[model samples]
Target: MVEAKTHLATKPRWLTPVLFSTTIFLSASLLFFVQPLFTKIVLPHVGGAPAVWTTAMLFFQTVLIGGYLYAHLITRYLSVRAQIALHLTLWALALFFLPLAVSAGWSYDAEQSTAGQTLLLFAAGVGLPFAVLSANAPLIQTWYARTGGYSADDPYFLYGASNLGSLIALLGFPLVAEPLFGATQIGWGWTVGFWALGALLLASGLMARGRHVRTVAQTQTQSAPSLKTRLLWALIAFVPSSMMLAVTTKLTTDIGSVPLIWVIPLALFLLTFVMVFTNRPVASMATLRLGYLIGLGVLAVVFSNLLGIHVSVWSAVLTVVAFFLTALYAHALLYSERPSAEHLTTFYVTMSVGGAFGGFFNSIIAPSLFNELHEGAITVAVAAILLLIRAVRPSRTALFGALALVVVILAKTTLISTFGIFVFGAIAIVLFLAVATTIRHTEHALAWVIVGFLVAGQVFVNHGTPLLRDRSFFGTHKIVEQDGLRIYGNGTTTHGAQRIVDLTADRPEPQLYYHRNGPMAQVLTSAKADASGTVGIVGLGIGALACYGQPHQDWHFYEIDALVSDIAHDPSHFTFMSRCAPDAPTHLGDARMVLAEQDGLSFDILVIDAYSSDSVPVHLTTVEAFEIYLEHLNDDGVLVFHISNRYYDISRPLGRLAETLGLEARIQDYTGNTAADPGDVGSRVVVLSRHSEGLGDLNADPRWTPLASDGGRVWTDDFANVLEVLNR
Candidate 1:
């Protein structure tokens, strides 16, 4: 209960904290829920392109800065009651476009840049809502201070709680909200929460009407921080925060976008902030220094071994660990140097600036500036510099020595890629020497030199476009050429490939999904067997299925990303559409929506291959999505699902869906290993048919077997239980 200091104060002691926590929790949760929901709604219009996330992030970061600025201005100019009223009024105004739906008639084409389109659409969808949401933490803290409720030291603790709310929202929205509620329900729930917050504000205002309004220390202090301090704080907060995102991009795109992959780095980043800000000593200088040295060394080794071996499950785990530990070290540093509550708005604003910088580098700038996701490498270097910036003792001289050693090592090893690993190890040794020297000046210089060389060497690797290809918001699409086959890969999934078989041929030969023996081949053959039968492809991976089509069959491609279509149709690349089916009907958007739109159309075979191999688009796996496939298919139509994963066993879920629907499904194990069953059998093709005769036909095939499932839970568009089926 929090009672006001003024004579008329009537609020209970627990009221303020309770209200504050709720405000933070509900607001953060609702805000994040909107992120995925809105993305899902407009996903079809934008073509589930990888870069969409990046574009959305940019909008979010920029808008967040604006929100913080608005909060600062309101705190400065308005009284507590006035600010509360103003915020309420704004809330009411925002409700006009309630139920949180995107504009109708929004159209996406195959030619648009997915990153840019997503940013624009997202900004339009929730700019005001985001602004309102971003201001909540700062405003509530300021309100607490104005009403003479808390000490200066208490505000940061509250901020930690606020972030806890953010973490919950991030975790829960994907797990609970998306699966439980539709977009309409999510929008309404958010609206209700917003109104509740407004009510809380009113209750607080009424309680504080006569309270003794003692000026807080923050309010009384008029001295502004120097420009340098402001700039430094902003840099410190912003760079690492943004770099965390950059690191996420690298790990997910360059490494893999498998579910739970992004969570690792983000969780570590948040935990670092928690440790640094808490009244705990877990973020000791010694621990951070050791962690930094180890993290940097590990990163160097990992990056240098980019192509030494194929990216594997073990490597993914190791990379996540490296990212988490390094990010923790860097972010903990930022938390250690956090500004006073009086300067919090400035601190947050600056943090947003750094975040924007990191995002810009990773999302927007990195694609054009360098090739690969140099953001991660760049972040490692930046983190090193930031770590050194915090040093106060005699390690400065040691830093210089360490820096010199790294420079020499890099120069000596520039010609050999593997030499980078040795350099990293040697740098760690120099860092240890710096820790031992007890000389401050030398450590600072060494730190600078190490940072410089690390960055310079990374840039050199990024220069000739050998290490990286094209990076967008969705992920990094690397161009790998092997034995004359040009491969375009996102995460671990080879989305597109072209063989340079004909050296003199203008267009590359279609490879991977577009190859002759792929799943699309079966769909085309079945469709060709019946000229009047329609064909529908659930997942449009570069429109590869269009290649196997005939002029007589009604061929339609359901693609989520127009960007993929653009890449596939580009004459400069493999011309699948032009060469195979010139006038193929391509529906741009989520396959589910497009399928639902076609009520009467029936396909002889509906192909389901929606997302990357690393990530199974959950919506596509749901019972509702399966029903759509069945409805669109003829009585004897086949539903071919491409279930290929290196980690999780998705077969059980498909089997369960088949059992639940009383449909018979058979699996085709396309990849077989004679050497040994490395437990990694690729591409389990689940063929489902409602008709028993169709099942009989599949049963006749020697490769087909009776699918078995526990028949536990069935996932729908609005409800799913992956926890039951997920691989532990």
Candidate 2:
């Protein structure tokens, strides 16, 4: 064991590093919890679009950079004791804004930009919390070096521990916490945890300056890193990070609107760090990377059509593994090449800068610059760049030869049949000219040309094609407008729009799960039976269900995102809203709050359809939510829930809740139907009725079967289990 330099408090040589690392780990874990939870809180207010997550990521990256800058200031100007005192003071001050919850009164405007709204809201809400938390690694590690009495190299190890905590918090939230405790309970729990953490910071501050550090003036070494090194780091960090975002985007867009699936990719990403940082290097890097790249290639092949295959659950799992491995490799490189303890804060600051750049490129730049995600192409380029940078003695001849080959292949791939012979001939001439020339620095100059061309080609490819991509604050939205109908997609799932096509036209009609025959359609049709029945639709996808409405029934559509509503309201896209419910109500806010204020304005039927592209909205599935839905529904009214899923069975949770509330429930499994005959397709509609007459009517339909409760447990706001209901 390494001996302690000047031991006080009888702490062992290993104890300081261990404690500091653990403290940093816990801090990072708690910090990450903020990203998902904060996002979830605002999701109900913002339309559940892929752009929302991206915008939130961009905000987080920005705040993290601020925190790193603050950390740099603390280490540069303040002594160890002063730094500790300052941090503790900040913690105390932050308490003035706690129970650490964002104000609920924040209004979302659809006409304003999505990115702009996200930034404004984030600035007002948890900006300080995020900025302070972001400083943890760089600040605490510096403190460990100065006051905790450890060798400079020891602080970097703590970074691995910090990421470990990050992984735990990211995974634990969806898999454990959110399902076990409702969002409100989790908020309270995190508040208490934050208070305890603040106390620990105080304790750490008291012990900070009791003993002197080996006083060595490590002055500023501000020489900029090499351009190659900067580019290498950016590429390495950016690829997998962006790829993870891409996968997440696809899942929500292709799959249904279920929020838990978001955790799947994030958890896998964290697991990658855990595997790579642990002693088992081979398991982390080599095998994982190979498996991931192969999986990514396969994913491109399987999901390219976007309309053909519906591998929501299985593809989601595969994507998680791919993203995890790629992210692991990239982050591991960052850890391995970490700067010395003396430059710890600078190192973290640079990483944050790189991270911010990555988010900017993927969330803001790519959608505008490229027709497709181009994630795989970018990943390969980055991996190659990182490999080249890692090589100590890179050869000019070898490098030039590789570049020539890559250029040749790319040209052939881009224009293979049209100009293959001419392109190959030009490539051969360039190689021959290179071999004949004895010019110095030729290889370096050629390398720059190759890189520039690669980037330009990527941009050109996108510009030349009309790729139907749109960028917002959170993510990219793909628009498919055809036959007078416009379909808005985030990744793979059709989010919202309106139907403008003539129903009698001889074309492929939009049908399947999105048809009006689903549960939402049932409510619209049934509610029409009662004159002046007001119906509320939570999610407004293509306004497809509006077609089922009768003139006597009043319908109000509550949509959080303006982008979705804009596309839905447009007559050229899907005209369901304009043609069917042109004069009906359109409430622009959270359904919960909007419906709450409309006392006695009960609906004949209430439909909860907020989806995360293809996943279930967990907030709507809880008992408290059910109670809210009931409140909005008239006595003897029916509550219809669209429970169609490709993966986990949700019938159990709905069944358990219906049984608990004394409301008769039945499940209709419509599994193998098509869109042409929308009414004939297979779906699982969880129908609920408080009135015996309503239940009798639903049961008489032969398609509805009474929910069986053998050993099923109720899903209250306090608890629910999705794993048990995954069609085992």
Candidate 3:
């Protein structure tokens, strides 16, 4: 009987580790899983603007700061029993808002302040549950450290384990959860996980019932850390948090705004936490030697216009590694400077503040202040400068090791359009290197050359007046006139190109996507069977589709980006809208939102020329969005979609959606003639309608074949897998 009693008494030893670790892990997993899932649900409301995700990130980070503050205060004042009761009551209150879904009524429009509206939407949607989960790791760790246990000497390892769960949940959501389950199911799954976390939290508090025991480390160092130390912790946390958004924004601006793009950078962000916050840091000061040097080159390639359009997978892989390694070194430093266990919650609160500030600056401030995405480049340069300023007295082997890598990297040569900065900027870099080596500051000199080139090359190469330039929350737009053609550019991809020189006696020719004999032109002409009719368009790119507008016809345009609308409507940028549909009514909002509010069967034809460069605005391709178009169309109205994209195989998703919507669809590709003008580039468009007769004359042509949309491949408001349609 005594043996069994002793065995039961000793159970608390093993129970505490599992108790604390499981509570933190479950809390963190649900915390991150809610991010992408809820974002995916509300994405359609904002037209899937990349800015939506960025602004959402800004809100999330800010809330995390608040959550951490709550935790810090609770740790300072609340007794263990009171803390457990308060937290449990908070979780119980949070459950009242559950199943953890975004309300349909919680939405934002273009005219409303996007940041303010989205902040409210996200707060209403997931704020309560998130706050309850956010405080769990730090709070639990604090409680554990106050009690006695073998592992309590460093309850911070529980923090690392928490991030490990976060990493797994982030990567798993897109890779496994999204592809296999619907949005509602995922939300319920998260809710179940949250309940499980709550149960674990209760168990942890029950297990750590003894006040006679405290970790020796906590009891030994009860003095508060210096304010300077606290502030430094925040700044260190800020750089990586801010850069996390910057890197994600950069990738989305280049590629499409998708969940997979979101998770990769976030997954890396969590991984650095897991690696650096462990009982023993994986990002050792020794490993930081090479990591610090490689970061400069990573920044250079990422910001340089050299890899603008042709960012291959190899380059993408390099950016990911650079992002990871740069953050790892910063965290290694953070780990080394960590305050003692007594100041645990205070440490996390300051770190959260830094992260929150970084995200706010990148998502909210940078967009308003800079005319371009200068955050990513600026963040990398700042990291590089910070690194070089903290350079260690390296051994000869470490210096040579860095130099060897530099030589091998510079040896990689390509054409002027492909990595051609070598020829134009190599002189300055080499000169700096020669001076640095001749003097004593070899490492600083090498770092400066790379940093200078990245900043300067962006200015010299990418900052040209391409005529009209504008930056928005969406992305940067550079309108450069070339060969007498006005080109609407979003980063490296051309959104629209139109000839400034008129090709006809009266009207400006639609030379690019809307050429005279193109599929779009053929369909429009057939629909013009009546001299006067109503025509609606989803995207207003330089108003290229407006050239088909006749004097007798009424025209309406719904454009998501007001900047794109302004550029298209301005006569100086493009004469298409002025010459063709001068007085057409323009609606400035997302197609799904704006058109859904319009009266039914008001159009003879609808043209969707709204590809934001190579990316398809995903929300517009789903069954619900298609149904919106049909509602606004006349009985026999034609529904046109310009599906030309370099990085996405949109044919499959659109086809799949069409099949689900019970619409007849056909596709046509305009392979521009070699002898034609450079502005007369090839294009692809898909046309869909309820009946064969609505397709007009395009159906008679052999090029207008069927679009095969799979029922299984259909995209709806609740579920979409962008990975399913990658061109690769």
Better of 2 and 3 by lDDT: 3
Candidate 2 regions exceeding 4 Å error are 1-11, 47-50, 119-125, 147-150, 202-211, 216-232, 254-260, 267-314, 364-491, 494-532, 671-680, 708-724
Q: Could you tell me how far off, in angstroms, the CA of residue 378 lies in candidate 1 after the best superposition?
A: 2.1
Clashing pairs in 3: 466-480, 655-709, 656-709
**Which candidate achieves the best TM-score against the true structure?**
3
Model 3 per-residue lDDT tens digits across residues 573-686? 778888888888889877778887766547778888777756557888888888888788777777888887777888888888777767788998778763666656677888
Model 3 alpha-carbon drift over 4 Å, by segment: 1-9, 215-222, 388-400, 403-421, 424-450, 503-506, 527-532
* lDDT, candidate 2, at 415: 23
User: For model 1, how does the per-residue alpha-carbon lDDT over 366-483 read when each residue is reduced to its tens digit?
Assistant: 7777645555666666655555553422244334443454344444534234654454545556555655564545545444545654554555443445323554434555655665
Top candidate (lDDT):
3
What shift in Å separates residue 273 of candidate 1 from its native position after superposition?
3.3
**Model 3 CA lDDT for position 558:** 83
Give the per-residue lDDT of model 2 (tens digit) for 1-728.
13344355476667666667667887888888877777776665555566667677788888888899899888788877788878877777766655555576776665677677777787777787677778887887777666545654445666667777887888788778866776678777777777777766655555555544533254334454666665666666666666666666666555533335555666666666666654446554444434433343333322332212244455456545545655776777766665556667777777778778767766677666765555434544444344434321124554445445434433443423234334334534564466346355443444333343334434433333322565444334566654445557744455544343453332223344545555444445443344436777886766767777776788888776555676667665556677777887777655665665567777776776665445545556767678888888878777777776655577777777787787888777766454454224565677788855665445576767787554566665345555566656
Q: Which order, best to worst by lDDT?
A: 3, 2, 1
RMSD of each: 5.8, 6.8, 3.0
Once all C-alphas are superposed, what RMSD does model 2 give against the true structure?
6.8
- What does candidate 1 score in Cα RMSD to the true structure? 5.8
Q: Determine the backbone clash count of candidate 2.
A: 35
